[model samples]
Every structure is written in C-alpha cells, then in structure tokens.
Target chain A: MGSSETFENELTQLLPRLRRFAFSLSRNGADADDLAQATIERALRSRGQWEPGSRLDSWLYRIMRNLWIDTARARGRKEKHEAPEEEAQFVGEDPRESMDASLELKRAMAAMNRLPDEQREIVALILVEGFGYREVSEMLDLPIGTVSSRLVRGRTALLEMLGGSADG
Target chain B: MVEEEKFFAWLDGELSPDEAARVEAAVAADPELSKMAAEHRSMAAGLRGAFGAVEAQPVPERLQAMLKGDGKVASLTDARSRRQARLAQPFWVQAAALAATLAIGVFAGSQLGGGQGSPIHPRDGKLVAAAGLEQALSTQLASAPANTGPRIGLTYRDTSGAICRTFEDRAASGLACREGGDWRIRSLFQGAEGQAADYRMASGGDPQLMEAVDASIDGEPFDAAQEKAAMERGWR
Candidate 1:
C-alpha cells in the first residue's frame, strides 16, 4: 500500500479511542460524533503536517481539543442571542441518557462533566486515557506542574461529586 | 495540599523512585492515607469504566468509509471546488443557488403550534423520534403524505444499510435513520421558529444537514419504487 494508504489504515484503527476521547470532551453523543468527524477531516487534509514517527493519537487529540475550543466559542456567541428560556429547556437534558453504562458509571461521568473544562481535560487524559503527566502537559501546552495541580483539583472535585457513593 | 499532591503523584506513578517509596511507606503506615488513596483509585476506575463504553460501539460506518478514500474525502474535495466555482458565478446565479437549496417554505399558522410538544425525545442520550415524527417516518411516504405533522423529505439507505429519512416540522428539520426498531435522529437543525424549510431542495440544502447526509448516504437516495419497497419491508 502507499504511504497515504498506511496512514488511513492507522487512522481507522484509532477511531474507537478517538471517539472515546471526543465523548469525554463533548459530554454528549451528537457533539462527540461531530467533533470526531471534524478531527478526521482535518487530519486527512493536513496529513503532511503529522510527523510519521510521532504518536498519531496525540496529534489527533490536540487537533480535537483545538477544534472543540473553537466550537465552544462559536456556540457561546450563538447562545448569547437566544432567549434564556429557550436555553433552559435543554438544560435538563441529560447526556448520560444515551449511554448504556451502569448507574455508578453514569454518576461518575456526570461528575466528570461538572468539572471545569481545564481540569476535566487533564483528569480525562490522566485517569481515563492513561496519558503520562508530561505527555498531557505537552499535548495541552502547559507546564507539567500546572497539569499535576489541575489533576489534583479535578480529582478532588470528582471525589466530592461522587459523594461517598464509592466509599464502601 | 502539597503533601496531598505528592500522594496523588505517587498514585499516578509520576514521582521519582525515591519519592514513590517514601509515599508508599507513608500510605502503608497510615490508615487515613490508605483510604484516601483507595478512594482515588476507585474513582479513576469508575471513570474509565464509564468513558470506555464508547470504544465498544461499532464505529459509525461513515467514519470507516472516510478512511477508505472514495467516500467523504472525495466529496469534500468536490465541495471545495464547487464552492470556488460558486464564488465566481454571477450575482443572480449565486442568489438562485441559495434560494434553491434553502427553499424552506413559509409554515402555516396552524403548523406553528406544532412546537408545543417536541417530535423527538431524548432517551438515554439518543434522540428517538416520537409521536407525529415517528409515525411520519414509519408510514408516510415522500411520494404521498397527509397534510399534517412534519413533511417527510428524501428516503434513502445510509452507507450502513439503515433506512434514513429527512423531515421538516414547524420547529426543526433533521435526518433520522431507522435503527433497532426506532427512528434515531442523526442530525437535527433547530431553525429560529419557521425560518428554515425543506432540506430536500434539489440544490444546496443546509450545509450541516447535507454534511450528515453526505457521510451516511451509500448510493443515490431511494427512488420512488425503491422507497416504496423499503417501506413495504418495514424499512428493515
């Protein structure tokens, strides 16, 4: 197969994991799929930018994070003009309803969603995706110390939200 | 808090060997520290279990096909060129394209009240078609429909072989695909109360909705005969 073909195959293998990370970021299925799709489009269009030997997953994650930031900003601006009542109707819509996870797992996800964006991303990178602190730092372009601090705060907040549900 | 950070760093194995040994010793000797460590570990496990479910789903076929090269990637290139060509067209041509694609009709006053109850409901995070929308997708044909509820647009089989249809009601317009006995909404565009119309306009449709259709559509949208046959087969 050609080099581009090899790249496509490797990207296909990464889809499930890429989608999982997207779900962690977006906290909903529709948005998660959209983000994942956008990421693939970017990765394919700029395939030359990716260093062949470097981690494709890491590159993809960074692209997804940046895309998500852009999407969030756009959504924020759009929401500004909408009536608060219109937005309120969707506030009670639980994203977890779409997942087939256990109650405890759903609760955990809900708590994770409640975390501040910066900390939530760090916590997901460390605890869920299992990236090393330094790796996450580089991916997020923050110092290792800052990543650790955010992870600590995020974990603490998560524990409190879980509220002794897992204590036993 | 500094000490707590050290404990977490140790838990995550981020510390130097000597520091890890020190924290290990401290936790081994202290019950409170050990319990806190256990709680953190369990929480991490719970999160992994929760988020990991997504990895177990069948990757959407559109995503898989995009990697196969001829599907979305080719179309994206086509769309880019088409856009550039469009920019070069005369003003009237550009206006016609916009009007042809966005041909959302002016909804009647009676239809406007259809917003009181949603045609889709979120159940377990998935948008399932409900009430009139569900009935329309299941029974109404693009060729024939009673003048009520949402208007069904194109009926087609997606790349994944699911029966998908487009619908426009007073409140929103989107695509829905039949999956496991329910009409699962794939893409929905909530237009500002009656501004957007039919997405099946032969030319340019809503870009986002068209993107969703582009990703999922396998071949040509079902022609009248094929649609009738698919409907007869219960959209299986």
Candidate 2:
C-alpha cells in the first residue's frame, strides 16, 4: 500500500482513542465530534509535516489541542449571546450512553468539567489519556513541574467533589 | 508537602524506580498516605470510565468514510488525479459506468417502494423526483422539523444557475437540481438510511453525491437565513 494509505489506516485505528480524547477535552459529544472532524481534516492537509516514525497520536492530539484553544477563544467571544441556545441544543444531542452512565462516572465527568481549562487539560492528558508528565509537558509546551502541579490540583478538586457526594 | 508531591508522582508511575520504592514504603507504613493513593487511583479509574465509553460506541460512519477517501477532506490532488483518470476513459465506458450507478439507485429505490410510491422514477432516461421526494424538494426547507418526510440537507444554486438541494429519505440520498420545475437527479447513492441525521449532511458521506455537489455548487450553501429566503422565493 502507498504511504498515505498506510497513514490513513494508522489514523483510522486511532479514531476511537481520538474521539475519547476529544470528549475528555470538550465535555460534550457533538463538540467532540466536530473537534475530531476538524482535526482529521487538518491532519490530512498537513500530513507531510508529520515525521512518520514519531507518535502520530501525540501529533494529532497537539493539533486538536491547538484547534480547541482557537475554537474556545472564538466561542468565548460569542458565548454571551450564544451560550443559552447552544447549551440547550447540546443537551438535546447528549449521547444516550451518558444517560446510562454510572453515577460515579457521571459525577467524575461533571467534576472534571468544573475544572479550569488548564487543569482539566492537564488532568485529561496525564490521568485520563495515560500520557506521561514529560509527554504532556511537551504537548502543552509547559514545564514538567507545571503539568504535575496542575494535575495534582485537578485530581484533588475532582476527589473533593466526588468525596462530598459519595459520603453524603 | 514535598512528600505529598512524591506520593502523587509515585501513583502516576512518573518517579524513578528508587523514588517509587521509597514512596511505596511510605504508603505501606502510613494509612493516611495509602488512603490518599487509593482515592487518586479511584478517581483516575472513574475518569477513564466516564470518557472511555465513547471509544466503545460505533465510530460514526462519516469518520470511517473520511479515512477511506470518500469525504471532502480527501486531498485535492487525489480528487484531481481521479478526475483525470475518469476523463482518460472513453465516452462509452463512462456512459456505461453512469448507467450501472443509476441502475443501483433504481434498484434501491424499488426496494424502498417501487412504482408510484417510489421517491424516484426514471423518466425519459433521467431520474426525476417523484412521490414524497418531489413534495419534499418542492416544499420542505432544510430548516423544517427533521422528523417529517425525506430530510432536505443543503440548498444551493448550481453552476448552471439552477437551484439544487440534497435530500435523504429512508434508503437513499442524492443530489437533485431544479430543472424546468422538476428536481432532476444528478447523482444518487444507496445506504445512508440508518445514519444519524446530523451525520448524513455533515459528512456528505456518499462520495459520488458529494462530487456532484462539488462540481455544481456555485459558492457557499444556503445558510438558515438563505435557505428560508430561497424557500420564500419558491427556490427560484
């Protein structure tokens, strides 16, 4: 098979994981799919920039992260006017699985969503995606110390949220 | 405080082996440290459980189709080369190929509901919208409630200045352009009947149908305002 074909196959194998990562970042299924779709388009357009032997998943994650940042910035500007309707529409599109999500998992995701963007992303990369501190630091262009600190804060906050509900 | 950071690093497997061993010893000796470690592990597992279900759900067909070079993101050069290859084929071969594709569409339409009930019918060697499809193309706006009959997707003016719209019913989807007040089937493909409503239009999954759209669309598609305006103008 041709190299681009091989690249597509490898990328296809990564779709499930990519979708999962996108969900963790966006905290909503519709936005996650949109983010994943945009990432795929961008990856295909710039496939030549990727060094074949390096980690494609990490590269794609970086691309997604950058795109999410840009989107989030734009959304921030429009959010005042658009937030209510957008939130209602997203509620309508919430995947059925979320309704069936275990109480613990739902609580966990809710707590994760409450985190500041920086902490949530760091927590997602290191804790959820199983990326190493160094790897996440490199991905976010942050120092290893920052990644660790944010992760600890995120984890603590998440546990605190879960702790209150579990005990109460 | 530093020891607390070390404990988290140990839990994450980020510490060197020697440091991990020391943290492990600390956790084994201190109930409080062990309890915190357990909580951290549980939280991670919960986070994984929360998001991992997305991986288990069927990957949307649109995404799978994209990797197969069927979506718009299929590189321009690839699309150009394919177009060139098609042009290289003789006229009869292309005509025969077109006939075969239309035949499949006819078969699929028949399977859906043949004769008067069929959404499409061959008239004078061209596919024309009929039955419920003709009604939808003439009256249904893309902004209309999606629960109704065959959903209209994009509305745009083709390069020929004729208005066109993409529609999907139960078994098939295709691009039809308004010609002489009848929606003429320019391209049709089978099997998008079961896809999510959002995906059908969002991905434009059927490549041949998308190619028809690409070849003829004058510019951007009609947005909600534009669609309503077009509908008001009777899609003139």
Candidate 3:
C-alpha cells in the first residue's frame, strides 16, 4: 500500500485505543469526542510532522494530550476561577454493567476524576491503558523517574480519597 | 533497602528480579513494609477497574466515521434512504420490511429520537431494553406470526459470550443480549438496512446490523433449523 494509504489505515486502526485515551484525558464524553475528532483532524492535517520510524501511538498521544491541554485552558478561561474541574470521564454510560457490578469499581472510577492532571495522565497511560512505565515515559517525553513517581503519587491520593488504607 | 517507590515499581513488574527480590524480602521481614505493599497492590487493582469503564464504552460513531473517511456512506442518515430504492425486493414489499438497521450506538444518541416516545429506558442510570421491546426480543422469532411486533432474525453469541439477537419493529431496530434475565440492548438505530443477503435481512437485517452480528456472533446465525432449535432451547 501507498504511504498515505498505510497512514490512513494505521490511523483508523488506532481509533479505539485513541478514543479510550481521549476518554481518560478529557473530563467527559462530549469533550472527549470533540478532542478525539480534533486530534484526528490535526494529526491528518500535520501528517508530515509525524516521523514514520517513530511510534504512531506515542505521536498521536502527544497530539491528544496537547489538544486536551489547550481545551482545558480554554475551558478554564470560560469558567474564570470556578471550582477545580472534575476529570477523566468514561465516554459512554454504564460500561461493563453486566459483568461486574461492585462498589469498588464505582469508587475506583470516581477516584479517577480526582487525580491532578499530570498524575492522571500517568495513571491512565500506565494503570488504565496498560502502557509500561518506559513507554509512558517516552509517550509523555518525561523521565522514567517522573513516570513512576507520578503513578505512586496518584495511587496514594486515590487511596486517601477513597478512604482506603495503604496498609489494607 | 526497598523504598516506597521501589515497592510500587516492584508490584507493577517494572523491577528487575534482583530489585523485586529485595522488596519481597523487606516486606516479609517487616509489618510496616508489608502494609505498604498491600496498599500499593490494592491501589493497582482499583485502577484496573477504572480502565474497564473506558474499554466497555461502545466505539462512538463519530470515531468510527473518522476511521472510514473518503466519504464512505455512514450507516445512518443518507445511506438508508438511497439504498431502499435499489434494495427493494418482493419479500420486503409484501411483509413491509422496515429499512431499520440498528446503528450500533445510535439509539443512545440524540440523532434518532426522530420524534415521539424513545424506545430505550434508563434503569439505575443504565440504558436498557424495555417493555414491548424486551418481550419481543425474548419471545418473538423471525418467522413468527406477521404483525407480531419486533421480529428476531438471528440468534448468536456476542464476542463477550452473551447471547444477542437482532430485532426491528417499524423504523427502529437493535441488537439485545440476555443479561441478568433481561435483554441488555447493545446497539439500536433506525434508518438504512445493511448489506446482508436476503435471508438474514428480515428480522433486522442491514449492513450495520450485520457488522454488529459479525463482531459479536460466535458462529453463523441460525438458519431455519437453527432458529427453530434456538427458539426451542429458549435463548439460554
């Protein structure tokens, strides 16, 4: 296949993962949808900027994370010193309702909305999306130490917020 | 020797065996260290649940469209109307086959509220198959008596191992799987039948519906013999 065709197919194949990443990044479904769409548009518009040898997911993730930052900035401007925003919404409602319905799951999902922006990204990339710390470090272009530190800190905060003891 | 961060790394499988062994030995020798390890492990377990919330979401239609650009006819909107003229066949005209191919996630969307009563109802904040629709999915067969509400065309197991059936009534159609003794509607939409062959098109046949069928089905949809057998088996 031609390079552009390959890129399109590759990009298409990445939607589900990218959409999940968008869900973890944005505060809610509508915003995530918009962000995912804008990210795709931007990636396609600037297709030349992506180095073919590099990882496509990492590249797409950088675009999505930056777009999310831009969006959060815009939303902050609109809200104008409002309360701290909620974060990390699940895209559609009642996902996995049939299989397992536990209060722990609910608390866990709710806790995801409480992590700080940087920490939440680490949690999503590492704990949620199953990206290894090294991959997440590269994806976010941070030091490996920063990645592990953020994950540890995010977990501590989540445990505290959920009334979970580190000991238990 | 093992710090909290190292414990986190150890639990996440990021540590080399040498470092992991140190962490394990430290925990085995001290209650404080053991508690920390448990806490970190508990936190990791909870985070997995957070991932499930996103993974379980149906692929949004807009996202699906982004994947299939080049002006590919989306499963909804324009495709159904244009295809009806070409796809009209004697069985459809005689039985008044509604051109409803349940778009995977469209019913939950605002687009097909089209007008009047919505077919979906939310229970405990979850959108579920309801009322006449629920009864129809559980009891109706594709070759059931005519005018008997939504017709169930294909019975098969979804990718998730749930038994889901496709049904359409009037202009609305959807796929529903049995869960907790109730049908959990996975996909619902109205407009444009999919490209399934004539036999598969009736109960709620259309390309989008077929796509859903392919995604979820364990094997071929029941033929007359299988459908009859499935009906006899009682959708277990």
Q: Which candidate's TM-score is highest?
A: 1
Off by over 4 Å in 3: A81-109, A163-168, B72-236
Provide the TM-score of chain A alone for each candidate, in the order shown: 0.84, 0.85, 0.77
Question: Which run of 10 residues does model 3 chain A get worst, by summed lDDT?
Answer: A89-98
- lDDT by residue (tens digit), candidate 3, A61-113: 88888777665555565345533443333323433232343445445656766
Candidate 1 structure quality by residue, lDDT tens digits, A4-72:
888999999999999888777764554466578778878986899999999999999999888776655
TM-score of each: 0.60, 0.59, 0.52
Candidate 3, residue A148: lDDT:
91
Ranking by lDDT: 2, 1, 3
Give the chain B TM-score achieved by candidate 1.
0.49
Q: Could you tell me how far off, in angstroms, the CA of residue B21 lies in candidate 3 after the best superposition?
A: 1.6
DockQ of every candidate: 0.32, 0.17, 0.19
lDDT of each: 0.69, 0.70, 0.63
Candidate 1 lDDT over B1-236, as tens digits, reads: 23978899999998999989988998989998888888889878878877787788778664675677542112333233234334332233343335433543332223334564656666677768888888999998876756878877677788888989887765566889998889998877644221122111212344455566767888766766777899999999
lDDT of 2: 0.70
lDDT of 3: 0.63
Cα DockQ of the candidate 3 complex = 0.19
> So what's the TM-score on candidate 2?
0.59
Off by over 4 Å in 1: A83-105, A164-168, B71-236
True-vs-predicted CA distance for residue A139, candidate 3, Å? 2.3
Candidate 3: how close is chain B to the reference, as a TM-score?
0.45
